[model samples]
Target chain A: MEKKIYKPTDIDIERLSALARISLSDTEKESFSCDIATMATYVSSLLSDVSAEHEREARSLDELREDTPVECDCARDILALSPSLKEDHVAVPLVVGKDKEGDA
Target chain B: MNELIFRSLDEHKRALTAREYSSEELTRAYLERIEEKEPSINSFVSLCQDRAIDAAKESDERRRNGAPLSALDGIPYAAKDNIAVAGLPLRCGSRILEGYISPFDATVISRLKSSGCVLLGKTNLDEFAMGTDTETSANGRTKNPLDENRVTGGSSGGSAAAVAAYEAPFTLGSDTGGSVRQPAAFCGIVGLRPTYSALSRYGLVGFSPSLDTIGILSRSASECADIMNATVGADSRDATSRPFPASDLRALIGKDVRGMRIGVVREAIGEGLSEEVLEAMQVATDTLRSLGAKMTEISLPHLHAAYAVYYAFSSAEAASNLSRFDGVRYGYRAESCGSIEELYERSRAEGFGDEVKRRVLFGNFALSGENREKIYGRAVAMRKQIIAELSSVLSRCDLLLLPTASTHAYRAGVKKSALYCKDDLLCTLAALAGLPALSLPYHRDGKLPVGIQLMGPAFSEDRLFSVAHLLESALDRRESAK
Candidate 1:
């Protein structure tokens, strides 16, 4: 199997760096750019000898579970463990909820 | 407390049933043990003190009323952090959900609760069950009880360490690849990855859903079989839950191996195997042969790709499964974001562990439109080929022989092997096939024990257990002779 190196774009960097929440200097970004590319190359071997039909479903098994059995206990527990909890939930400083779609 | 922690779950259950130890006493014993040992061993992430004591007190009440539910009643068992316990932080050994607790119990947890089992605590694991070594946990690394400086074998390393250290009689671990079996081998305990759908995945934070199965680690395979007997079967909550028939997990316990067909995969005994491991495997094969079992040599060239396929498929799926933790709905949220994308980037970057980020970034790259065909698709095809080849091999024989690992216990403090160490290693290949594999510990050799793995066709857990039990007994006899 032939291997191709996929370098992380600036947008990819912006996306992941923000997601990871770590301040990466330009030097770190430069290194990470190389590291991420190498890592992608390493995982790219998964591309070899794998069947296309098998992955028709990207995540493989389509395990869509019902959103029922609203668990109040787990939330209470997490809230309880939170360095700080309020209004019956673990309250972080603030969060901007993303639109449900396109995230996947 | 340490002594109590070391006893098997069956022993604890017997004591509880006989009133030799009150539920409160047993719970207290484990709690104390955790306090003393966990600091050094680093086994648990969360210990639900009030909840565990309350459950123990309730079990005490039931015992007092002469109405205890089952043998497992009042016994304490730890869950791998990846598996949720209602109201406990399912940190998954990662910072992403450091304080995030699910609102419901994992299906296995729920079943265990209904059976009257006490939650000892939650054990440490690889960050999101990604690595084979537990060093990447956000909290801290879980040390192997047997060898403190060495890895405890991960994803399920914490659970295995707990069982090995006697922190808990039995513990729950998720096996995606060799998470359960590898640790079991490292810790010298019995670990069983039951048939693919035998256990429900309702509450297990998915690593690789298709290959992930909730495995049980215990002092003996029998203990694991009992737990499996209790937990296996369909669950309404998990769509993939298979219809497992209710029968004694060890029903074929005494099935003589007089005429059973067993084939040892010649390809499995390649270079990466250690001398000790080779000798141990030879003993197991010899014992089965001596017992009148017809053993044969088989080939599985496709297995060479199990690691490749496993990494590709599992990592790709992981990138998707973890997308839900993006700071918005639940979990850790990093503040001071200008845009939604910033919120996601910062939240994830801050919340997830380095290993998780590595998986996600790598997984994303693999599944991206351009590389999807080149990598993820090809790995899937390889997996399909491997599975089909395994099925064909199964057709030739009833069971396949496996040397749990290609090496013996790598002693603590050793820098990574600077050699060809991939082949015949890790529990991923059998796992990728979603087949039932059992790792049974042979006798201890100067405190380091070895194990042989047995892999059976899909849904052949019953058959696998039967063979395993026989081997265990025979191995026990061999140990006594020594």
Candidate 2:
């Protein structure tokens, strides 16, 4: 099997930051890009031609707990901790709609 | 009253039982000492004054009725902010978790509370337990109690500092890689990172789930054993947790190390080790030899690759674990956002610190579809090899001894990013293998203390404590004889 070489660049870092849902400043991106490039060289050498085996078998189903629900009094406390809240649910910015100006 | 703050758990119990002072009085002394020393140490992120007092009073009452919970009934300790304590702010030393309060206690907290241990407050840490130095904490960096100009090595720095400063007798910290051991070494105290799954992790804010383990920082190895005895047990909430087979975790204390096989990791001794640390290691080895323990030199060929492998795997895990911190729920929210995606981006970008962003970006890069097979997959393979090598070595020897960090605590505000990566190599072997490791401080005259580490095979925490206690006592005698 041929192993593909991976070297992280500025574009790669930008793509990663976006994928990670984090907006980074240009300077920050540049700094991280440099660090990642350094790390890339180190990682490539250490991991070259290595292949991973499947992880050890997980606990069997019989060992797992029954998927059941029980009542508790934590809801009120949990709700109180939310940053923005409605009557019974956490509030967030619009998920599907466009701007207030209706540009979309 | 002030002296009570430094007393061991057993001594405190005897004092309380004999009515030298009430638990409330002892609690008050600690609180006052915290107030006095906090300016210099900056160890605590918050103070649970009211809660501690109430719990201390309750403990006093329990003792008055001759129904004290246990030996730890009146002891006060702090938890790293990353661990949940119901109704207390769980910022995790990051702005992202700012204003967030945990609704329920973590399993360890629950266990400690049940044992009648009073929670002094939450201590500081590197944001989300990412950095080796506590400098990255949003709360403020924790200074080494031994040297004001130096850092208490972190992400467990505050916990170690609190104990070292005598603001609290002991504190809880979490280890992933070397967070617990490094800080304990830096603060001149004992730190224990038990075998993974020996303690529950239900409420610990996960940085790297596979590597993360809640650890103890205290003045003595026996105290660590006491804390472990109280906290070690299986919990349904944490599936990984298992019942420790040993009934008495401290049963090995005071036992001689004669004929015990100690493997000295050869790679850890040369090149990068500071002169003082090398001398300390010599003293430790000489002490063990004098005590009749058999010391042999051993090497881990993969030791050089550990730093890169640890970062790759831990970063991948961190990326996944930290993905839950969007603005919708309990943490900080951006002022304005046109869409949910924007909210997440802005909230995270603003909320996270530089090191976090660096790791997240790198993690995502490594785990990306094209690179995942090359980086993360290979890291997985490398981890297995490391673990196998450690297991093989442990089979040959009862324990592995090495310096906990390459040097004593470095002065605060040094360029930490590169320096920390190198310093942490000594600590990752135990974390990678899920083995029990303990760090015992070796003091030097007019210089910061050096940490000598002992690692044993999985589930060997009891033996590790015994050996550490014997070594600690021997070191103490040597110091006094000087």
Candidate 3:
């Protein structure tokens, strides 16, 4: 299989930051694009060189705790830590366009 | 009694018990040292002076009533900012979480508290514990106690420097990929990354869940063992934590290593290792050999791929973990945003440092498209191979010996590059395999100390500490003779 070469551009970084939900300044986009491109090339080389025969198994869930309900008083404390709280719940800026004032 | 700040945890405990010095006095001395050294070393992010003094007073009262909490009663220690301490700001060395106070104590902190260990404060780390040097911390870079110009290896640099500067007798640091051990090595102290799951990760801010471990840094291996003895146990809150049986780690310190076999990773000492560090490893191996331990060169062929594997796995996990820092619930929020997306984008953009942003972007890129299978999948496969190879090599010997880092701590503001990855390469092998590893300061190249790393099979901290204690004693004797 032919490997796809990675050459990150400012557009790619912009899209990636969007996907990551992180806004990048114009200066940051230029520099991060280069750094990501360099890292991508390095990772590509490393991936292409290594054999892919061995697959490591993740930890088994057999030892996981039983789903027993337990009361915790941490909710009040967690709400207190919120940047913006409406009553007992965390509040955030309107997500749906319909909820915005400018939207009809 | 001011010198009590430099004494071992055991010595401090004895002094407290013998009434030679009050816990209040001991805590005061450490607090004073922190005040004096903090400007030069830049270790602590928040100093819990009032709380520590109150705790010290409580400890004094307990001892006076003949009801001391534990062997570590009244001993002052610091925790890396990532570890949650109730009422203490858990900034995690990042602007993103600045002023975020923890509502609950981490399992390790609670355990330490139950034992009456006085918490001096929280130490700085790489922002979100992502970088090798503490320079990435938004709080400011932590300098090496020995040389202010040099970096304290990070992201546990502050914890290491705090101990090295005698600001605290011991401090807790978390290691994902050599964070604890590397900084410990750089600062010339004992740092142990216990077997994964040996210590609870419930309260440590996640970096790479599978690889993150709460570790201890102290002036002596025995103190690390003491802290380990008190802290290592299962927590139902953390599914990854196992039921680790309590062992008298201190009792194992002076045990004989007459027939113990140590494997020296041939790959570790190659190419990137500095001459001074390599020379230190040679002397350390020789010292261990003279102490009746046998040494053999062993190969873990997949070892060289550790940095790539670690980056692929850790970055992916870090991206996921850091995703929680949206503007809504907690932490730094962007001042003004019309939409949720902008809120998240602007908050993260403004809050996260450059290195963190780069990694998160890299993670997104790697996880998208065919790159996921080509990079992430192959990395997963290589991780298994690395683990298998290390297991096989470890089966032949009691422990693996290597350099904690490729070189001594670099100058502050050294650019992050591929070359810097070499610092984490040696330590990543043990981390990847979920085995216990320790960095013990063995030699000094000028003012900087070189650390020799010892890694052992899973849950083999007892034997690892035994070998390290012996090596530490021999090195001390040699230094005293000189």
On TM-score, the candidate that comes out on top is 3
- lDDT of the structure predicted as candidate 1: 0.76
Worst 10 residues of 1 chain A by lDDT: A95-104
DockQ of 3: 0.30
User: Candidates' lDDT values, in order?
Assistant: 0.76, 0.85, 0.84
- Candidate 2, B1-482: lDDT as tens digits: 47878777678878988878888988898999999999989999999999999999999999999998988888889999999998999999999988998877999999999999999999999999999889998898888888889999989999999999989888999999899999999888999999999999989997898999999999899989999999998999999999998877866577778999999998888898988778878888988888899999998987876877788888888888899998767588887799989999999999999888878877887888766766776777777777877888989999999999988898899946732475577899898889999999987657788798999998888779888887886554345436
Question: Residue by residue across B1-482, what tens digits does model 1's lDDT show?
Answer: 34666666777878888898888888888888888888899988889989999999999999999998877789888999989887788888777686687767888998898889999889998888887667778888888888787878777889999988877888999998888888888788889888888899888987778788999998887778778877888999888888876477755456677888998988788677777677777878998899888999989876666776777677778887888887887778989999877788778878876567666765676676556666776676677778878889899898988888766556543422111224423477787778889998776446466678999887777777777877875554344435
True contacts kept of each: 0.35, 0.55, 0.61
Segments of candidate 3 deviating more than 4 angstroms: A1-5, A55-104, B417-419, B476-482
TM-score of 1: 0.85
TM-scores vs. true structure, each candidate: 0.85, 0.90, 0.90
Q: What is the lDDT of residue B88 in candidate 1?
A: 82
* DockQ class, candidate 1: incorrect
Q: Candidate 2: list runs displaced more than 4 Å.
A: A1-11, A49-104, B418-420, B477-482
As for TM-score, the candidate ahead, 1 or 3, is: 3
Complex DockQ per candidate: 0.20, 0.27, 0.30
Return the number of clashes found in candidate 2.
0
